[model samples]
Target: MKLIHAELIKLASLLSAWIAAGLATILPAAVAVLNSRSQVSRGIDAGFQDLAPGVIGAIVIGVVAVSSEYLVEGAESGGGRQITTSLTAVASRSRFLLAKAAAVAVTVALLALLSSAITLTTTSLTDETVSVGTADLPRVAGVTAYWILTALLASGITLVTRSGIVPLTFCIVNMSVVSVSFLLTKLTSWANYLPDLAGMHLFLRDVHGSVDIAPLTGGLVMGLWVVVVAGIGFIVFRRRDA
Candidate 1:
């Protein structure tokens, strides 16, 4: 228990982690509120239903949280040697990783919950006649899932690359863009099978019947990605020097 707590503290000690988390939760929420007002004037009573764009910045947060660990150096900053020494003191790598993952999950989930609440509340306040209900639950869950997957992938990539900025760049430019477009067509079996494409279906449920992929299929695809990425990350973390 002490070790886990220490690991959590270590993860939180970085300035980037807190900054990323703050931006992830706050910026999107602020935009969601603004979008609600604009949508109202456009005869679109949907409110912040289209605030997904604000969440793109969240991927950067998820990536930076784990990557920042590699940058610490020397006694004052808890260098690479300190990490290995701490692992020895802690007695188990799995437990350390678990604690780190737990912190990541908790942070991302909280941020997502806040963002969703803002979106829902803003939409309701703006659309006098429109009432947002629990129907948004699935979409909210999809966003949460996206956040978790992003964190897991980022942590694993950071472990392998050891450069926070590099993995963050890939996540921002490649993963975000690629995932957004994974379900554009159904021509190939593999295209929709990708994780983001699958998860995106849940968010696009309003048009799932007309779209190439079904919501259930999208959920399944995202699930597979989560499992695969997490499994790989766990294996790598267990073997790495850390």
Candidate 2:
């Protein structure tokens, strides 16, 4: 509990984390408003598309959580790293990893919840074509899970890479207008199974290609990917010197 609390404190103190939260909360709502004002087509899934890029915030949060620990201070500060102090404080690698992951999960989940509410509200108000209602609740809940899983994957990848540059850039590029997954889908149906693409099935009814995956199945596939990635990260973290 203390370890988790300490990790939460560390996350709270990070300017990047706070910036991520603000970006996560605002981007979707702003997009939704713009799309609505532009009078987007009255499709059932019109506004939901705006929520996609907002996951960038979750990715940033996850990356920084792990990357910050490895950052070495300047020579004036004795060129020390936070990971050394963190490991010294908590001898149990398993507990420390769990605490760090838990903190990221909780923080991302809350941020997702807030972003969903604001974005959905903006969509409902600005886009008179679609009214937010009871039917939208499940999708709202799913986004929280989606963002949490995304954040975990980011953190796990950071653990394996030991730097944010690769995972962060890869993920941000994939979330951009021309996504690798989207491009891959043009060549093969299997691309739908990618973690980000598969997870979109949870909250999105209109998905890529003719592949029809149930929401539950989408969640499961994403979860399996997380387990695999996080497992590898755990093994590496336990075996490697901090």
How high is the CA lDDT of each candidate model?
A: 0.63, 0.89
* TM-scores for all predictions: 0.77, 0.97
Candidate 2: how large is its RMSD?
1.2
Residue 146, model 2: Cα distance from true site in angstroms: 0.6
On residues 1-242, what C-alpha lDDT tens digit does candidate 2 reach at each position?
Answer: 89999999999999999999999999988888888877448476766677877899999999999999999978997999999999999999999999999999999989888888888888888877788888888998788889999999999999999999999999988887567987888889898888988899878888865588898899999989999999999999999999
lDDT string for model 1 (161-192, tens) is 66667767656665445543444444555555
Relative to the unseen true structure, what is the C-alpha lDDT of residue 126 in candidate 2, on a scale of 0 to 100? 80
TM-score of 1: 0.77
- In TM-score terms, which candidate is top? 2
* Candidate 2 accuracy as lDDT: 0.89
Q: What are the root-mean-square deviations of the candidates from the true structure over C-alphas?
A: 3.7, 1.2
Count of residue pairs whose backbone atoms collide, per candidate:
1, 0
